[model samples]
Target: MNLTEQVLHVLDNALSLQGRTAGFTRDTPLLGALPELDSMAVLALLTGLENHFGITFSDDDLRGTVFATVGSLSALVEQGLARQDP
Candidate 1:
């Protein structure tokens, strides 16, 4: 799957959305918008992203804005992948 699809997958799986993510678009609000996205869920999503993408996020990279929207989160994943030296 591509980065956006991968990100949507992570959110869907982490939140147990049960394929409801099909309604989500790049503009979908995340942080404050999704009631399922609590602090624990946030951590889970971050860890899931790291595991799925094989990347690490520093404290500096964990800003809330990164999770503001589906697009932003996917961008972070893309950024993490881009930083990989390969």
Candidate 2:
């Protein structure tokens, strides 16, 4: 699957989102916009991404900008994969 689909899957499962994430688009608001996206959820998402993609996120890497939207999150994952490449 592509980054967006993979992220959507992770979000759906991690947050118990009940498949609601399928409606999300590139411009969809995150962070403060989604009530489900609380502090705990943010941490869970980071952990999920790290475990799923086999990458680690530093404190400086965990920023609101990376989780701004589905597109942004996918871009962050792509960047992480690039960094992991030999």
The most accurate candidate by lDDT is 1
Cα lDDT listed for each candidate: 0.90, 0.84
What's the lDDT for candidate 1? Answer: 0.90
Model 1, position 44: C-alpha lDDT score? 94
Backbone clashes in candidate 2 total 0
Each prediction's TM-score against the native? 0.94, 0.90
Per-residue lDDT for 1-86 in model 2, tens only? 77788888888877889999889877777777778888899889888988998988778777779878888888888888888899
Clashing residue pairs, candidate 2? none
The lDDT, on a scale of 0 to 1, for candidate 2 is 0.84
* TM-score of candidate 1 on Cα atoms, chains taken together: 0.94
Candidate 1 lDDT, 1-86, residue by residue in tens: 77798899999999888998889899999989888999999999999999998999888878889989999999888888888967
Top-TM-score candidate index: 1
- After TM-score superposition, what is the CA distance of residue 2 in candidate 2 from its true location, in Å? 1.1
What is residue 11's positional error in candidate 1, in angstroms? 0.7
